[model samples]
Target: MNAVNDDPNGDGPHHDGPHHDDLRYVYAVCRPLAAPLAADLTGVGGVPPRQLTHAGLVALVGPVPERDFAEEPLRAHLEDLDWLSETARAHQRVIDALTSVTCPLPLRLATVFRDDSGVRAMLEDGAERFHRVLERIDGRVEWGVKVHMESEESAAPRAPADAPRPSGPGSGRDYLRRRRSQRTAQEESWQRAEAFARELHETLSQRADDSRLHAPQNTELSRAPGRNVLNAAYLVTRADSEEFVELVDRTKDEDQGTSRLRVELTGPWAAYSFTGDEKDRAE
Candidate 1:
């Protein structure tokens, strides 16, 4: 959905095209921050972010130019990988700052508005879910866990690395037997890897307050060493971070049956995956 200027307060026809006036770029929502933000912190467009309060919640916003951030221009800019990467980095930096200070409900990337009035409207509209989600995530952090199985070619067991390939099928009967045996072994290894992933996710879920099973990331995109078997997020209390991390680390065993398991863990971050209500986030 387009996150363009939605001036609900009859603020004239929505300002179209590039204009001199600046739009508000929202980063996150949270209860009133107790500590002050770092003086040097900057958000998208290199603009300093400030808080705007409404309905007992604070929204972190910064000014962005309409020429670049307006609906038509913004959609075009999104296609530029360099632009998207820089914007994402800036966005995450702001969210990270908020995470350090309080339990922030992070908005999706490019959440923009015409002005403070539009932002306030959003806050009032989703006030109920925002409060409910805030209460649920307060003082809690998210952790990520992933499991991968090393490529079969790299983890060969039956043949030695230095073995020479046969110039031809030395014996058709023997070649067929060897091929069948290799296929069987590979199938068994894959099955074992899948079972290992399930067991580990269950174990981690038992320790976390809430868990989300995210779709496995693409190998090409993630550059993961092997097939991504599991990708999950867990919500645990701040106090339980140490134990949760330790639990996750203990299961990163390389020797789990014939399947070489590669376990990955990330976080102690804001609950990015937990409070993803698409309807509310579309704002």
Candidate 2:
């Protein structure tokens, strides 16, 4: 196996040495030789991440200099919002490029290997499992489907009170009661919306090879003006992607309601959330 170690003095974020750093990190793995080299995409971060091919698999990676990524700095930087956002965006950009060309097995955040040799060893050791993962996701893409309830203000509630006033010493109890009532109503609304989302996922998943619900990121809730009820991604055959999108559009039209929770679908993307090295026989 060929080992391509990170260039110590490479023009990356943390450039400080001539001796190869054992702290290289692997981002994604795709079909060997078949995968695009690091130059294809523009606007990727952390210098130009390269590809290391082993057997029939290639790992996409960038140099993580020992200094910047040392435990203390790495931990401190991870807690910084701007740093995390940029890192995530850069990572996604790489994933996007690879997925556009071929099925890629995306590594979770913070997946760092000791060195290029370590990366190659992993590809070689896990060659069979990796092939199986590729087989399952080959010719397929992932699509994100989210259902959210419109803002309560936008979907004006029928019941309204002038204002809330504390009655007596039992004001705390009254507050709790009001909060409970509000929660109950919200829960009911969310349950209904979730049911619809599940039905939509079921219909589409039956036609898809795989489907999974990702934990709703708080950013989704903060950015969206509505309450996000479901966050899901479906691994669909390229041939069926268009049809699946059409189905989602059609379902949205059919399920029009006063509280009209919205179902938003995005992507003919690489199946990042579905494939993994480990296999669940029951799956």
Candidate 3:
């Protein structure tokens, strides 16, 4: 793969310079190929993406502002949720484009090299590792399964007349009792949710080539209903994606009347979860 700035206006970064404002942001590495990426594919900071080759490997990278991506500055930017979200989306855009045409070994978000030569050197050093991961995911893609416990409706059958009432409007004693009951119900719901999540993960794991369990997303972050009990990713062969989708759909149907558990399936994503050693395997 030859490195050529995709920009047509002649304002892209120069291969050689100490401008203190430009650095190479790497998105992924893959075996060299004949075809080029889409003409309009851009990467971090909206810079035109290009590639750098070394030995049998090629890195997909784009220019990012050094002031915004440098080690110290990048750390600061990471603390700002808005900055991190935008940058991560940009990084994934480049990786997503590469994955459509090749099995790319995705790099972590905000992975920047001093320059093109730095990217080449890194590729040369990690050549074997990259090849191994690429081979493992060559014909596969990632899918996500999330299980949330919907808030229980308040329509359960009322207890017998002789049973003690839970509490009344806003009295002090009633408030305390309600709080205690609420805590107990929440705990029980979570316990049941965990068991359901475990079984769901196990069922899908049997159909996937690889699987990972990510930490549950916070409510604010996920905007999901009730509580998140399972956040898992599965790597399945392209040919099996349809079967996997069907299986999840069936599970959702089974939950319709028996439980508050709601299963959400998403994907055909780049194999993000399967490529890295940083993920926790579902046990």
- Each candidate's TM vs. the true structure? 0.86, 0.76, 0.78
Q: What is the C-alpha RMSD of each candidate to the true structure, in Å?
A: 6.8, 5.9, 5.8
Residues 150-247, candidate 2: write the lDDT tens digits: 76556766655776566889999989998898778767777777788788778888978888888865745469768777788988999898888999
Ranking by TM-score: 1, 3, 2
- In model 3, how many backbone clashes occur? 0
What's model 3's TM-score? 0.78
Lowest summed lDDT across 10 adjacent residues in model 1 is found at: 1-10
Error of 1 at 243 (Å): 0.4
The runs of at least 3 residues in candidate 1 whose Cα sits more than 4 Å from the true structure, single-residue gaps closed, are 1-20, 157-164, 167-170, 277-283
Give the number of the best model, judged by TM-score. Answer: 1
lDDT tens per residue, model 1, 1-283: 2233332111334323323488889999898877767666778877667777788888888888888899999999999999999999999999988888789999999999998889999999988989999998999999999998888877775777789866565677778889999899888988998898899889889999899898988999999888899999999999999999988888874468678889988887899997865465588
